[model samples]
Target: MVDKPVPDATRRSEKSRRAIHDAALALVAEVGYPKTTVEAIAARAGVGKQTIYRWWPSKADVLLEAFLDLGAQTARELGQEPYVIPDTGDLAVDLKAVLRATVDELLDPRFEAPARALAAEGLVNEPLGREFVAKLLEPQLRLYVDRLRSAQDAGDVRPDVDPRIALELFVSPLAQRWLQHTGPISYEYTDTLVDYALHGLAPR
Candidate 1:
């Protein structure tokens, strides 16, 4: 039996999809999400308007895919898996290491611009905000939840604590600092967050 050749149309579609993602990210970074349009992305991507519409329902969809791809690429570059948080028995050490890497990612030029644009838009655009939180943010956050639960089981964390809320004590502060430029991001800062969260600020 002969091997079947890959379909030319499928190959073409994949190329177009990558181009669209690149174009959408570029446009969002350059002009912000509210100003980026399907037509503009198609033009920049060297594809037709119909091609974008055929693949995605809206510009938000295209941007979401682009952001997700960027995150995966960052994960690969960091020698980390995109979907899992490390659980190395010492919860503070593991959390600090991951967060230090995240600080590097947030400061990366390629990731920062589009991410800032999308995040700013998400602040005011309720539907897009919710979509981003649900699809891109929450899934990543669940990894922390899993790690915390394991820590609790190991007696490394307080059993009565809610993992979801407990994770936020460190995670949300870092997120706010990065997102709003409220403070400096450093290895020390993140390490401190881990220490503060785990040991409690009330002298325990």
Candidate 2:
């Protein structure tokens, strides 16, 4: 009898990794991060625990990477280029467009549950929180910083303004509202935020 062709190792490994990521994300979303475990993820993934151990040191790391993958995957599904802040040369228009997209992402049910779980855990878990910020959140924020710097170069933003701090004006309020459920989130709400942030409260 002819020997069967061997499966491609790289393709097999990638499929397993995607399975592991999905399992980890779903488990955390269902049970919360504190209760999610490597064994649980591995079992859910249909892979051995040793398979997980081979790639990640801990559950936190797995979840972090899983979340990152989820973002990229979700962006692809939405037809967006992940991690990009578009520069249309009109600062207000650019910022508003991005914030509107953010509103849509924050409200997406598939992303919301797992993202909230991880974000909640990051608040009290200092090391995980720091790592989360450093690895995931900060990089996205830096895109805003870069865009603000470019706006400054065009004299759209004041040269003396700090791009980092200026971004917080629009970004932080929406984050607070989302995380705390303080108010509704919508394109309109976010558009208003961009307006107020860019133009200020006093009569324009």
Q: Estimate each model's TM-score.
A: 0.93, 0.93
lDDT of 2 by residue, 63-182 (tens): 889988988887888787856788888988999888888898899887889888988998999998899999988988999999999988998888999888999998998898989899
Per-residue error at 135 for model 2, in Å? 0.7
Q: Candidate 1's residue-wise lDDT over 64-152, tens digit each?
A: 89888888888888789756777778998889988888889889988888888999999999999999999998988899999999999
Q: What is the C-alpha RMSD of each candidate to the true structure, in Å?
A: 2.7, 4.3
- Per-model CA lDDT versus the true structure: 0.89, 0.89
- Quote model 2's TM-score: 0.93
lDDT of 1: 0.89
Off by over 4 Å in 1: 1-8
- Candidate 1 residue-pair clash tally: 0
lDDT (C-alpha) at residue 65 in model 2: 90
Q: What is candidate 2's local distance difference test score?
A: 0.89
Residue pairs with backbone overlap in model 1:
none
